[model samples]
Target chain A: MKTEMAAIEIRNLTYKYQNAEAPVLQNLNLTIEKGEFALVSGPSGCGKTTLCRCLNGLIPHFYGGELEGEIFVDGLNVRETPPAKLASHVGLIFQNPENQLFSFNVERDVAFGLENLGVPPEEIRRRVDWSLELVGISDLKDRAPWELSGGQQQKAAIACVLAMQPSIIVFDEPTSFLDPLTARGIFDVIAKLRRKLDLTVVVVEHRLEALAAHASRLILMDHGKIILNGEPRKILAEAAERLSLKVGIPSVILLHRRLSKLGILEGLTPLTTSEMAAQLRGVLNRD
Target chain B: MIRLEDVGYVYPGGVEALRGVSLTIGERSSLAIMGRSGAGKTTLIKHLNGLLKPTSGRVTVDGVDTRKATVAKLSRKVGIVFQNPDHQLFAETVEDEVAFPLKNFGFPQDEIKARTEWVLELFNLTRYRKHSPLTLSGGEKKRVAMASIVSWKPKYLVLDEPTLGQDRENKLRLRELFEEFMEEGRTIIMVTHDVEFAAECGFDVALLVDGKVSALGSAREILSNVELLKKASLAAPQMAELFLELEGVEAQPVFTVEEAERLILSRLMSGSGRP
Candidate 1:
């Protein structure tokens, strides 16, 4: 169900926090189509988080910052709409899941957003059940949010967002605190969620190695602006220095960069280690 | 110099966060604690600095029983940098935040100032000395926390997820500081989920699972052990996993990009693994 309508569109957006000297996000313009999966990465303090706030209507509304330009979500003007009004169409999963979840139980936490939207009690119950099962946290429905592990708490937060039935979802480093195995599992769940729903996924993460292969588009930000935006491999291959942070670049891509510099390998960059190994097999297997 | 003897801890809520965990960290060594969340890594490290005493078993540093010693006395030998900076930060400025530890430890103003300034420079926070730590980004806050703890020069440094908010360059910088500490014969114990960080530092790894010491050994040998890592719900670093998948030229599960590149180049250049 690919649609031509842009799930998110920005026009010359610039924002600065109240006390901050310079704009955190400056003159950023972009468009993400419905159902598109985009991964955003950059060094710390590079405005990726600020851009996420802008996408979710938290920049000017909740952050109390000076914001300029325009932002549209699902063809609706974000500047004119309150965050409460935009919650139904755009769901933002923050960096710390524990901070976002405050309910007595996992079930109630997931249903909190639905209840806020005046969803009927019957529908709320059904959604809480459906989302908890989808996120694989149904068994922990009775447990308090504080009782779950970091990974499980993150899953619960995602369920809360999923229940809102937003067409666009923004995950702000959702798995930063998780181990590699659990982090990969969360991404797998997200991929499954994408297949099951018509959604635009924007993931802002430092662990790009785990999620690079799944991203259809990669956006690299620096100094409050997007420095590179394109296919994953191409961006990593061409403008790697700007994307120099190790956490965000895949190991395979790092190896590829080194190999290219030594003139040992060239032509295409691999986003995953397995993909790189596949590319190397041909070279290594040639007698 | 840091040792835990069959240490087991049960929180007030009746949750067994740690159990039967025994490990010894030698002086002048770097050890990485790897485990999934709630697998008892944090609980285990808290025992290092007397933040959380073991309900059973024992934890000792330098033959002194941690359970009997005061936290203030233990702070001189073992300083812990928590994952969340806000937990430890209270000063209005970053400079004062780093100084608070030294001053409370009864160091003279000159020593406190010197130590605070040195750590601020080391952590790249000198420019932000006057700024409130609360206003900094997550990465900067993490650095501030470290600077505050390391100012007193403890005998053992226990870091809880130091790389939580850091990128690759920042991690490398932090590794340099860790290396500097190692040179001074200080034991460094870090709890982290960053497998790449573990591999980069060449630390001896202690894997904690369900409050037990699941495995402890050279990170190289253990991180390459896929089955053991899988048992704890952990994955080998991407480089290690890739090396294992390759069908050529005696590849040991390499962990870092440099090691992987060396293996690939040796095979391809010598044409040894070629069909």
Candidate 2:
């Protein structure tokens, strides 16, 4: 059940909605270990969301589809287990916070998930406070979820899921609606949570520059399959063209590519701005 | 020609969203509004097109007081594309979605058809003209939303987070589209958190913080101001950050990636040994 074992294992997974003519995900096999920060990215309809749903037991439980293949989460078969049973081990935060938030105030919203599991009142109270503090929104506990800003509401939503103390957390474009500053703050909170709790993190995002520095492994999916998966720097360097085809590479990556083409940057492929600056410094100092 | 005079807005729940925010947007110029989630950027943008009436003070577009005009009336001068495409799109087909606004403005049938065709072509949505609005991808939905407002040809366009779901190539295309609009003498005010987009689009920049105008100047001035950007909870564009970290050599913050490359190449060509 720990991260040393596979947190999630998918084999030959293929799924198609009842109304769809073609499969959204096709013959996909992937393994997600515990305590790893994994980033999933692909084109809009490339089945990243569908794949995440399968991993968290939402495929057969929440959504009915022509599902083929086996999926396991935390040593349990997702097909056999309902989401209610898996909720304690895997937490899913959707793209839009409005869809997930139903409570009146921030505190009640964070406690709602734990309450559904029939947790003790005292334990629920403790987890709510701890989750709010983890997401850095304990101060807004009294405010209505609707009254909060888009970023604050997203934090509250994350806190709600965190209160359940899931071993693995999956985020589907959590920062898509947020402004840049708030997006950075949310990523910071994610980093803090991953380190403090040693939880497995998987996030699907289009904005790579923001997530690149923090992700331990970057998985690039295209047309319902994983095209690239490795250390962020290695996959980025090896699959630059495919990535560009899928979601379009970030500006920083393009710059690094251009520098490499001109023979200015050697060996090291910088991913973040700070890394790029350091590379430039090394180049200048060598001269 | 867009002007705000001591504009202050307090929501019905008594939360002060904007406080004494006053600024001017010139004709045919692009302005980028940067802010945190609660910095009141959306509130300020709503005033441009009369979506929200100021609780105190005044807002005028092209010398006409906004308080005296309705959204439909002001929309002729100001077209606003909201953040969520779902909130603005109601028509079944993409063509109908873009044409609805034109029909509401009472344009002739032929004119609506012509304008819809032109805007669809501009956004590369001509292929999906007959497609259902619900069936489009997220980036395509954003384009349709933009096309819906732009078909009206408002003199000034205000977009809220236009590039939220866009890929890099689409983002580049959007920059080109904004440039074309500027060339046509249409003013553009965009609310965005993508500092890199702000820099590449060649727009003057404004930082909104705590419901007030924290900093306003050319893109070079605002992007290079690390202290000001940090105070507003904004990250500088990668090029700007790189330039800030470089030692000895002096250069204005390069806004675009191409410009940054050019700056580095020029420095190397000149044989400037100073790091």
Candidate 3:
């Protein structure tokens, strides 16, 4: 039964930052199954970051907020557990990669978490090497964090979390500071990690087109509540519902819908350019 | 017009942020500066407003050397709204935040008040003028920042990643505002990752790679070059990529849905009957 439990479960979660007028998150209930990659997107000030903070025991414990919720990470109550203890179960990556990596070298930065947990020196070395290799930055192991490119820096940040071997990882707008092309590469790395590790991944992002195909689920948030959550393609396929809600449907998805409306396209909603091209070929009366 | 003449810049810690970057922006025109993070987009824009001096070359605005002028003097000709509004905002209220720039240019009290109020109303930030800037959302804070610098109505306006944190709706509103601004005969330059926004804006793009200008041309011409954009760590807009990926289709840089639809129609209805 314990093994069959969801990776994360939240019930009636309501939280307000200290000295703030209203709760940023309101009466939210969400359950992410094990090994699911969920991309959460919303306008700023919509509690996307606050929700991520809750999972790593930062909301009630670190931020000192008025929290009314039961958040269980792998069946352990996040509030009851200290952030330091819960950190092993759930890793958090902030928006700015610069602030997250501070060690002299990439290798040291990734191993910093393992060291704090009192892992054996030999085991720490092996895991640190493995994480660096996993992120494809093993060649940069000795380089300073500040010297790396933004995408590389972010990968180093992710490697830092991967070394801890957390079951659940939540990224708060990981590529907000990156260019679209580099952002696409980062998403590929994350999607690959999700598949290889069987890790439950949650990424809060606004760059939709690049990540939509890589994501299994999409959750739209507004006014601190879940407005829509379902399979990524299905949620994105509803142009009228999404537009009324003010979601930035990816241009590719919107193009597909527009073509479909004009009777130019039919069948499944395409989430990527290649998919849309395939649909175009089908419409040409070709196989 | 603004011109960068073989400009090169090196940060204090010896980081060569820009090297041999030569470019020009015509009067009352729009250009979108784009590249990977740390590719010196901010460093290049800073030179336009005299925020930074070129280490090895020259930058001129209307034939005036930037190195000969102070930032205060250059601000009258060029105004820059930096990335991250919170870093540039310090006033207790949005009103004060918007008023500071006018006061700096030494405008008369009444004129400052008039300009500030007008910009606040124009930017739809009049309601938030009394509220703390730190308390505002990302979109609201961005509006407040834009209202402040734009109050002076500088000849050239430079924005670094103006749409970075904004949602699509807010981005649409900002785009309309910028279009209006350009229509008033003021030059506007923006640094962004929003390829669709760049394409819609129909900007002359300056693509930077490794701190040097790699390519400069119209958005469609430069952005549609998949090999070129990839060298700079960029990907063309999804729709444009679709056109490029589909075999037998010509190299048409269709970015927006309308352009994509039109291209599809030409392919389908015009004797091809393709989807």
Which candidate leads the pack in TM-score? 1
RMSD of each: 2.7, 3.0, 3.1
Candidate 1 chain A minimal-lDDT segment of 10 residues: A239-248
Order candidates by TM-score, high to low: 1, 2, 3
Candidate 1 residue pairs in clash (backbone atoms < 3 Å): none
Report the CAPRI category for model 1: medium
Clashes in model 2: which pairs? Answer: A3-A34
Q: What is the DockQ for all candidates, taken in turn?
A: 0.61, 0.43, 0.53
User: Alpha-carbon error at A179 in model 3, in Å?
Assistant: 2.1
TM-score of chain B of each: 0.95, 0.93, 0.92
| Chain A TM-score compared with the true chain A, each model in order | 0.93, 0.94, 0.93
Candidate 1 vs 2: which has more DockQ: 1
Select the stronger candidate by TM-score from 1 and 2: 1
Measured by TM-score, how close is model 2 to the native structure?
Answer: 0.90
**TM-score, each model?**
0.94, 0.90, 0.90
Q: Distance (Å) between predicted and true CA of A80, model 2?
A: 4.1
Better of 1 and 3 by lDDT: 1
The lDDT ranking, best first, is 1, 3, 2
List runs of model 2 lying over 4 Å from the truth: A1-5, A57-65, A241-248, B91-96, B106-140, B248-251
